[model samples]
Target: MISAVFWDFGGVFTGSPFHLDDYARSLGTTNERLLEHVFGRYEANGDHPWHRLERGEGTLAEALEAADESCRADGIEGFSAEGFFKAMSGTSSEERRDKVMAKVSELNDAAIRQAIITNNAKEFGDIWRSLIPVDELFEAVIDSSAVGIRKPDSAIYRLALERLEVSRPETSVFLDDFEPNVAAARNLGMHGILVGEDIVPALRELDRILGNDGV
Candidate 1:
């Protein structure tokens, strides 16, 4: 039986992390430019700045300043982490994720251990906790920044399995909005779901997997 349910934070919980189109528009450029400027280059294909931000390594402002420095080095001007973060934060107002958050709370029980496995910068947990009592809702939370590894990397997924104490990958269900991350979890032998608006079926699908797992 599925012993655990691992959730991704960004698109799955809220919406996509900073719309690419919005970033592009704000920068007076195309989506490709925004992608190239902020995320196209990285060491070891890792999310360095975001990882640091999520792990509590620095504040949003601090990350922004560092990004600005990087921009200066690259001879690019006017890129705004503050603006980007503001856009990403976009009013934590909508009730779009209420159902899913409530679902997590509803499923809070011993039969199933729940966790959040997300690629976030430092302070992400703090921000999420402030938005909701995440500690109360989840048995564990594996933030990439804290772990020094992000999703699509097998090690981080293994970390989630370890924290949940579930030795068998088949005993877990991983949910994320990104196809690559979902694929990575499946490769690790865990059931993976690509979250979207129509997720009732996915929840039921999870129940089926859990049922089979003997939980």
Candidate 2:
């Protein structure tokens, strides 16, 4: 019996606010090369500045300075990490997805636990936090910056399960837009749902997995 539901913020909750291609275009470089320059070899999980920033080891300004230097070394002349993040933040829509929130409310009413698991930047916490009613809709909000660990890491998943008081992974369902994150959750024995452009199908699938449409 699934007793808990885990949600990913950013892409899963709202329209994706950042695009590599768009960022690359703005910087006059190819997406692959730009990503290599900014994210280093491991991208999300490596010892790069981005990873450091997400883990709360450094300030946003320090990370931006590092990225700016990297861009300069790559011949991108004048790249500003602050500008990049500002543009990325601008892409978010203020309108919440009523349908998904309604489903969340239904699940809450069913007495199933819900929590948010996000690998997000520390500075953007207020912006993303405002997008949802954390107190009313979720029982826990585990953020990578606050916890010092991100998704695709088993420890974070374990942390969420622990906080949710779920002793077995099978008693929970996880939803994320990123395939790697979803796969990681599945590996830990939780039923994983990949939320894409349209969330209705995924929510419906979750409802089915929980054995009730009312959920």
Candidate 3:
């Protein structure tokens, strides 16, 4: 049985911030390449400006400046971090979010542990919280900015498991839109589910994994 459920706030609960791929295409590059320039190789921890912002080591202005410079150097024109963020939707689908919330509530009622592990910025804290009943829904939220570390880094995952008191990593499950983050959790022995553009299928998989199917 799954003892705990870990969630990624951005893509799981809300529309993915990653859909800004249009900007990548506009600059004649794939989203993956542009994202590497912005977010760095997400699988490894590094000093990328965005990474620093998420780690609370730098301000948004600084990160954006550095990222803009990187884009300029790469000839990716008209790079606007502000605009990219604007396209990051807060909620996926109202009904879909409600479904996930209901599941969370059900798990909470059953005494199954829950926590949010999001690679987010300090600047957007209040804004993100306003999108959901975070405190009511989650026992703990490990925001990378607050903790000085981000996902795909083993330390952060370990920290979440520690806080959740999940002694057996295999008994825990992680859900995220980013595959690398999911892979990282899987590497740590937790079951990881990758959420795509549509989250309904992923939700069904979650139920299947927890044996909450057909309920």
- Candidate topping lDDT: 3
Over the stretch 14-119, how does candidate 3's per-residue lDDT look in tens digits? 8886666766777787787777777777667777888888999989889888878888898888878666676565336787688789989999998899999999
For every model shown, the clashing-pair count is 10, 0, 0
How well does each candidate superpose onto the true structure, as a TM-score?
Answer: 0.78, 0.85, 0.91
| Top-TM-score candidate index | 3
Model 2 Cα lDDT, one tens digit per residue, 1-215: 78999998876678644345677787888766765666565326877887777777767777777878888887896577666766556555544466678888998988999999988788988887787787789999999899999778889999999999999998899998778889999999999998876777888789799995243
Candidate 3, superposed: residue stretches over 4 Å from native:
212-215
- After superposition, which runs of candidate 2 have C-alpha atoms over 4 Å from their true positions? 41-44, 94-96, 212-215
- Candidates 1 and 3 compared: the better one by TM-score is 3
By summed lDDT, which 10 consecutive residues of candidate 2 come out lowest?
A: 87-96
- Evaluate all candidate structures by whole-model CA lDDT and list the values in order: 0.72, 0.80, 0.86
Error of 3 at 25 (Å): 2.8
Which pairs clash in model 2? none
User: Which residue pairs overlap in candidate 1's backbone?
Assistant: 1-213, 1-214, 53-121, 53-122, 54-120, 54-121, 54-122, 55-121, 55-122, 56-122
Ranking of all predicted structures according to TM-score, beginning with the best and ending with the worst = 3, 2, 1
RMSD of each: 3.5, 2.6, 2.2
Q: What TM-score would you give candidate 1 relative to the actual structure? A: 0.78
